[model samples]
Target: MRSECPVRAVASGSGGRRSYLVTGYEEARLALGDARLSKDTAAFFAGVDSKRRLHPAVAHTMLAGDPPRHTRLRKLVTGAFTSGAVAGLRPFITRLTDELLDRWPADGPVDLVADLAVPLPVMVICELLGVPETDRPQVQRWSAELFAAGEPGRTDAASYAVAEYMTGLIASKRLRPGDSLLDRLIAARDGEDHLDEDELVSLAVLLLVAGHETTTHFLGNAALALLRHPAAMERLRSAPDSLPQALDELLRFDAPVSTSTFRFTTEAITLGGTEIPAGVPVLVALGAANRDPRRFPAPDRLDLDRDATGHLSFGHGIHRCVGAPLAKAEAHIALRAILTRFPRIRLAVPDERLVWRHTRLVRGLDSLPVLT
Candidate 1:
C-alpha cells in the first residue's frame, strides 16, 4: 500500500464506518505517537453508539484510555517492569526455561509452541500475578479464548470469565497478601490515591494476558525465522552474546502484533499526504512499517548485524508495550536455552504446511512442530 498511498481510507464497512490504514514507516511512527489520535474508546463510541458498551474489565485498561487515566494506571504498574525489576527476574526466567526444556522428550518431534513458547510466558506471568498453579490451566484456556479471532461469543465469555477470576483472586489476596505484583497492586488500592475495583481487575487481566501473549508469539516466530535462516541460527549458536541483537532483527522481520489496536482521530490529521477525517478509526500496520524499504535497507532480508532500533514491534510512544523488557528477557533466555539443548533441532514438517493462528490482534503459529 505504501507504493500507492501510505495512508488510505478503507471503504465503509457493514457498520458504514470510515477508517484509515497507515502502512508507511514514517506515517505509522508519527500516527502512533500523535496525541490527536485518541485511544479513549469509551469516549469515541459514546456518541457513535450509545447502546454499545464494552466489558468494564476490557474497557477500563491503560490500553483503552488516554492521558490522565492512562498515565495513572500505567504509573501503578510501571515500576514492576522497569529494567532493574526485570533484571532481578532473570535468574527465575533462566531457571524456568531450563526446567521446561528438561521435561521435553530425549528424542522426538515436539511442538515448540505448546511445549515451550506458550508455557514459559504463561507460567512467568502467572507467577508474577500470584495465580496459583492449580488455577493456571483454566487461566490459560480463558486467555486463549480471549484472543481467538472471529469468535465474539467465545471472546465475551472469556472476558467475563477472566474478570470473575481476577475479582476472586483479588479478594483472596486482600486477606493474605504476598510480595507478588498483584499484592502490591492491592496495596496500592488501600492508599490515598487508589484504583477502583474495575480498574484493578482490568489491569490485572491486561497484565496476565499481554504479559505472555506477545512473548509467546515472538518465541514461535523467532524460532521459525532462525530455522529458515541457517546462517542466522549458526551465528547465534556460535556467539550466544549475539542473541539479543538477532532478536531485534527477528522482531522487525516478523512482528508479533500484525496491526496495532484501534486509535480514533480526535481531529482531522494528515499522514503521508492523506488527510483523514475526525472520529474515524486508524490502524497502524506494524508489520508493514517494520519492513518499509524507505526506512531499512534491504528491509525484507534478515540482517542480524543491522541496527533495528526503530522497529514498531512493541509499538511507539506512551502506549508502547510496558511488558517489552520482561518479554525480551524471557525470550532471550528461552531461545538460548532451546538452541543449547537441541543443537540440531529443525522443522519436522515442510514450511508451507505450518498453520498460523486465525487472529488479527496476534500473529503466531498454531503449532511449531520440530525434530530435536
Candidate 2:
C-alpha cells in the first residue's frame, strides 16, 4: 500500500502472528460493512492506561456504539443534519462565511486555520448544541486535548473540564429548556425516548467535537489541495457547478479522518489472509482505502473531474457520518467563497515547512498559511 499511499502495510503483523493489514478496497468494505466486526473499543479502552488523559465517556461517541444504542443516539441528532436540515442552515452558514471573509486580511498571508476554518464550524456547532457562544472557545480547547497527544495531564484535565461543563449545561437544560437541539433532545421521546443525564451529556460532547473538528479539517484539507494544485483551484473558481465535483475529489484524495473511530473484531475473521481474533481492535484506514488503485485509477492523484462519491470519508452503511450533508454544505460554501474572494490564494510557507499534527486521528495541518 505504501507504493500506492503514504503509509503501507506489509502482509505481516508482530509476534509472527501472521497478521496482515487489509489495504485493498474490497477488503476494507468487507471489514467495515460486515456484521462480524464490532464498533466497541472496550478491548483497548480497558488495556490502555489512561496515562494520556481522555474522559472515558468522551472517548465513546456514536463512533463507538453499536445496534439499538447506536440507533438511538444517531436518530436523535441525524435529523438535524440531513440534506433538508443542513440546507436550512445555509443562510446562517453563508452569513458566517461572509462575516469571516470581511474580517480577513486583504493583502498579506493569514493562517486560514485560525481566521476561518476554526471558528466557522465551531460557532455552528455551538449553536446546534445550544452551547453559549462565550463557552465555545473553552469547549473547543477541551475537545482538542481529549484527542491530541504529546501532553499527558493536560489532555486529562481538559477532558474532565469538558465533562464538568457539559454536566452543568445538561442540568440547566433540564430545568429551563429553550428552542434548540439540546432542548428538543432533553425533551425527546421515542416511545419514552428521554435520555438519562449521562447519555445526554455524552451526545452533547460527541456533537460538539465531531461537528466542528472533522468539518474544520475538511475545509483546511480542501484548501491545501487547491493551493497545491493551482489548475484544480482555478477550474473550481471558473465553474460554480464544478465546486461539488471538486469537493468530492478533495474528500476522496485527502480524507480528514485518517482512520475511522476504532472498531473491534466480534468473531474471528479472515482479512487479507490473516485471522483477526475476536475482541482484537482494528483501525479502519479511510485515507488508505480512499487511494486504493484497484478501486480508483491514478488513485493518488487528485482529479476534480472524477466520480469520487464512494470514498469512505464517512464510514459506510449504518455507521455513515450523520452530519455528512451539513459538512458538505459547509465545505462548498467555505471553499467556493475562498476561491472567489481570493482567486490568487497560494501557500505562503514552503510546503516542507508546513507541519501536521502527528497525534491526530484526523489529518490536517496546524496552520494553513495562505496569501489572500
Candidate 3:
C-alpha cells in the first residue's frame, strides 16, 4: 500500500461510503495524533439506520468518544496504570507467573496460549479489578467472544453480556468496597465531577477487556518470535536483564493489534500527498507501519539491538494505551519466567501448522503448542 501511496481511499462499506487506509509510518503517526480525525461514532452515525444498536454502556466508552469526555474518563483510571503503580505489582506478577508455570506437566507438550499467555493477564487484570475469582471464567469467555470477527451475533451478545456483567459488578462493589482499582474508581471524585452509572459500567468493561487482550496476544506473538529467532532467544536467556529493552523490538516485529480502532476525519486532511475528505473513516495499519523500511532499517528482520522506540504498537498521541506500563511489566515477568523455567522449550508443531486467530483487530495464535 505504501509503495503505491501511503494514504489512499478505498471502498470501505456499502452505499458508496469511502474510507481511507494509512499504511506509511509517517502518515500513520500523523493520522493517529491529528485532532481532525474524530472518534465519536454516535455522532458519525446519528441518523443512519442499522439493524443492531450497541448498548449505551458499550457505545459511550472513552474509546468511542472525542476529547473532553475522553480526557475525563481516561484521567479517572490513569493513576492505577502509571509506571510507579505497575512497578508496585511486579512482585505479584512474578508470583503469579511462577504459580502458572509451576503447574506445567513434567514431560509433555503444552499450549502456551492457554497455559500461560491467556490466563496470566486475565488473572492479573481480574485481581486489579477485584472481579470475584469465581466469575473470571465467564468473563474471559465473554471477552473472547467479543473479539470473534465475522460473528456479529456472537460479538453483539458478548458485548451486552460483558456490559451487563460490569454493571452488576459495580453494584456489588458499592455494597462491599475494597482497595482494588475498581473500588477506587467507584469512589473517585474531582470536585463535582463523578462517573455516572453508565460511565462507571462502560469504564469498567473497557478496563477489563482492553487491559488483558493486547497483552495476551503480545505474549503469544513475542514467544513465537523468539522461537523463530534462536540467536535473539539465546541472548535473552543468557542476559535476562536485557529483556526489557528487547521487548520494543519484539513488539515492532509483530504487533499485537493489526490495525487501530476506527477514527474518522471530521474534516478533509492530506496525508502522504493524498487528500482525505471530511467524515471519511481512517484505519491506521499499525502492523504495516511498524515494518515500513523507511522508518526501521531491515524492518522484516528481528534485531533486538535495533532502536524500536517509535513503533505504533500501543498507538500514539492522546489516546495512547494507558495500560502499556502494566502490559510491559506482565510481559517482562512472564517471558523471563518461561525462558528460565523451560530452557529447552521449542515449538511442537511445524511453522506452517500454527494457526492464527480469525480476528481483524487482534493478531494472535489460536494455540501455541510447545515442548517444555
Candidate 4:
C-alpha cells in the first residue's frame, strides 16, 4: 500500500479523467494558489461531474466563484464579522455558552456534539442571519440532510429545499430588514457595486452552512485533540492564557477539513516536476499538508505554543475562510469556558470506541461522549 511518489496518479469518477493527489505542503500550496488552476471544472472539461450535486446549497457559496465575482461577494458582508461585530456577539455567545453549560446534567454523561457543539453554532449562525428561533430546527434538518454524503438522493432534496428556504429568507430580510448580516449584505454597497439577487442568495447559503457545519467540526476536533493530550489539557487548564495558542495548535494538529476545495486544471502545467494536463481535478489534502515534515518539526505532536496560525485549516490564498475570525472566537470562547467550568471534564467512553465520519471531506466524530 505504500508508494514512493510526491504526487500520485488517481482515477476520478467513472470517466478516465486524471487527478494528482498532492501531499507536500509547498507543492500543494503552489498548486492551490496557482492562477492557471481553475476552481470551475465544468468550464474547462467535458462531462465532468459537478461535486455541487452533493451539497448544492454549500456549493452556491463564494467558494464556487472565481476572481471578480468572488472578490465582490466576499467584500459585501466583510463588515458583518468585523472585530466590532464579533465583540458585539461576545455577550450573546457567552450567555448562550453559560446557558448550555448550566443545562448540562452535571452527572453521568453527555454527547458534546449533540448537546453543545452542534446547537451552539446553529443558534449563533441563526442569530447572526436573523433566522427566527422557531425556524432553526428546520434549518438544522436541511443542513444535516445536505451534508449527508452517502444519501445522494436525500442530499439533493435537502439542497433544493434549503435553497428554496433561503430564497424566502432573503426575501423576508429584504422586506423587514434587521441589523443581521443578511440585511446588511442586502443594503451594503461599495461605490455602487451592490450584490445582485443571485449573489445575495449565494452569500446567504455560504453563511448558513459555514455558520454551523465548520464550527461544529472544529469544536469536535478540538475536544478530541484535548482528550488525546491530557498533558496539554492540564497545561491549558492551569494556564488559561494558552487557550488561543492551544486552539491554533489543535487546528494544525488534525485539521477539521481534510482537503481544500477541488481545483480543476485549466491548462497543462508542471507541478512538483510532474506534468498535469488540462481538464483534470486536483485536491489539496490539508490534513497531509499540515503534517508535512518540511512545514513543522514534530508535525504530529500537539505543541500549544507552536506557531500554527498560517495552517491551511481555514484554507489558503484568495479562498481563505471568510468566517475564520468568527469561528476562532466561538471555538476559543467555547473551549475556554468548557475547560474553566468543567475542570474535571473527560471522555465518557474509550478513545477506540469513537466513530469518525467516514466522509473524507469533513473530519469529525459522529458523537462525542464526555463526562463532567
TM-score of every model? 0.97, 0.92, 0.98, 0.94
Model 1 score (lDDT): 0.90
Q: Highest lDDT: give the candidate number.
A: 3
Model 4 over residues 1-372: C-alpha lDDT tens digits? 002555667877665766788877777788778887777533553474555464444555687767877787777777777878888898888899889888888874988998888889999999999999999989998887777878888888887788788889888877887888877777763237667666677678778987789899999999889988889888988998878777778898888888787787778888877788877777788888888868888898888879988788888888778778888888988998988988889999998999988776888888999999
Which candidate model has the greater lDDT, 2 or 4?
4
State the lDDT at 275 in candidate 3.
Answer: 90
Whole-model lDDT, model 3? 0.91
For each candidate, the alpha-carbon lDDT, in order, equals 0.90, 0.79, 0.91, 0.81
Which of candidates 1 and 4 reaches a greater lDDT?
Answer: 1
| Residues forming the 10-long window of minimal summed lDDT in candidate 4 | 48-57
RMSD in angstroms, all models?
Answer: 1.4, 2.9, 1.2, 2.3
User: Each candidate: how many clashes?
Assistant: 0, 3, 0, 0
Question: Higher TM-score: candidate 2 or 4?
Answer: 4
Ten-residue region with minimum lDDT total, candidate 1: 46-55
After superposing candidate 3, which stretches have Cα over 4 Å from the reference?
Answer: 189-191
Which ranges in model 2 have alpha carbons more than 4 Å from their true place? 2-20, 43-53, 189-191
Q: 14-127 in candidate 1: lDDT tens per residue? A: 866778988999999999999999998878867565432346797657799898889998999999999999999899899989988988887768999999999989999999
lDDT of 2 by residue, 238-331 (tens): 8977797778789989998887776767777777655677766666778888888878999989897789888888878888888888889999
Q: Rank the candidates by lDDT, best first.
A: 3, 1, 4, 2
Q: Could you tell me the lDDT of residue 347 within candidate 2?
A: 91
**Higher-TM-score candidate among 1 and 4?**
1
